[model samples]
Target: MHVFLIAALSADGFIAKTVDQISTRWTSKEDAAFFAQKTKEAGVVVMGRTTFETIGRPLPDRKTFVYTTRELLGFPPELVEATQLPPAELLAKLEAEGYTQVAICGGSQVYTKWMQSGLIDKIYLTIEPVFFGTGIRLFTEEITNTIRLKERHLLSDQTTVLEYEVLR
Candidate 1:
């Protein structure tokens, strides 16, 4: 299975203004269209509990998986499949279930955890044009591994989309 980290970040590398809030300013209509297209192509999508909560609901037409250690209750029926498994076990189970591509959508800690585990294969980073002086970063720890840029697309509003493959 291939794991990809997909997220939009400020120029300074912050994914959100805070842990609980989604960065609306950085997310444009073009970004949403691009994400919807990516989401349509993905077979499975995985995210942390906080990310799920922040979004308020699961995405339609995709098999969404939420990674949380705590019990997830009170969600709408068939909204999305929620699970509380560690990264390795979850990935193993998904692979066993025949999921080929998995996208790791995130907050910050989840991205850090999966990146540190060396499970991520590719990353799609949307670099917004503005900078947030204080906000939640994409990763908590510094990564020393080299990530090679595979592709890049310039958006209409000057936002750049970068694709990088994580070198093992």
Candidate 2:
């Protein structure tokens, strides 16, 4: 299955001002609109529990899989809140459910894990024209891999969205 990771970060590569402040407030409206459109077209959206909590709800018309090691109680019926499954296992399940692709949609930890596991096929990153001096980065751990730039688009708000294919 094709798993693409998507995120909007500051020019300095920070996803948010802080871990707890993981919202789209800093990103431009164009970036958010692009994000929503891509996620909607995806077969399913997968994110870490913290990321899911930040979102606060499942996206419409898409199955959202929240990966957590903790015991989640009273989750909304629309979301699939469960413990972390291996990337391959998760992809297999998604494929069996007729999903052609999955979108890894937030938080540094989740992005790092998937990238480290070599599951991300491509990345759609929108770089906003701002700098946070210091904050939560796009990846918590080090990832040393090459990516071929597929294309780039400068949004109406001047945010640049870069699409790259992971070179594996």
Instruction: Name the best candidate (by lDDT).
Output: 2
lDDT tens per residue, model 2, 37-102? 888888489888888777776777778888888876776755665758888888888899888988
Clashing pairs in model 1? none
lDDT of each: 0.82, 0.85
lDDT of 1 by residue, 1-168 (tens): 878999998888789887788655458777877777887687778888888888877787777888777777776645567776778888998889787878888878788888888888999999887787998888989876679999997876677889999997
lDDT of candidate 1 at residue 85, scale 0 to 100: 71
In candidate 1 the C-alpha lDDT for residue 20 amounts to: 82
Which numbered prediction scores highest in TM-score against the true structure? 2
For candidate 2, the per-residue lDDT at 33 reads 84
Task: Note each model's CA RMSD in angstroms.
Answer: 1.8, 1.4
For each candidate in turn, the TM-score is: 0.90, 0.93
lDDT of 2 at 159: 82
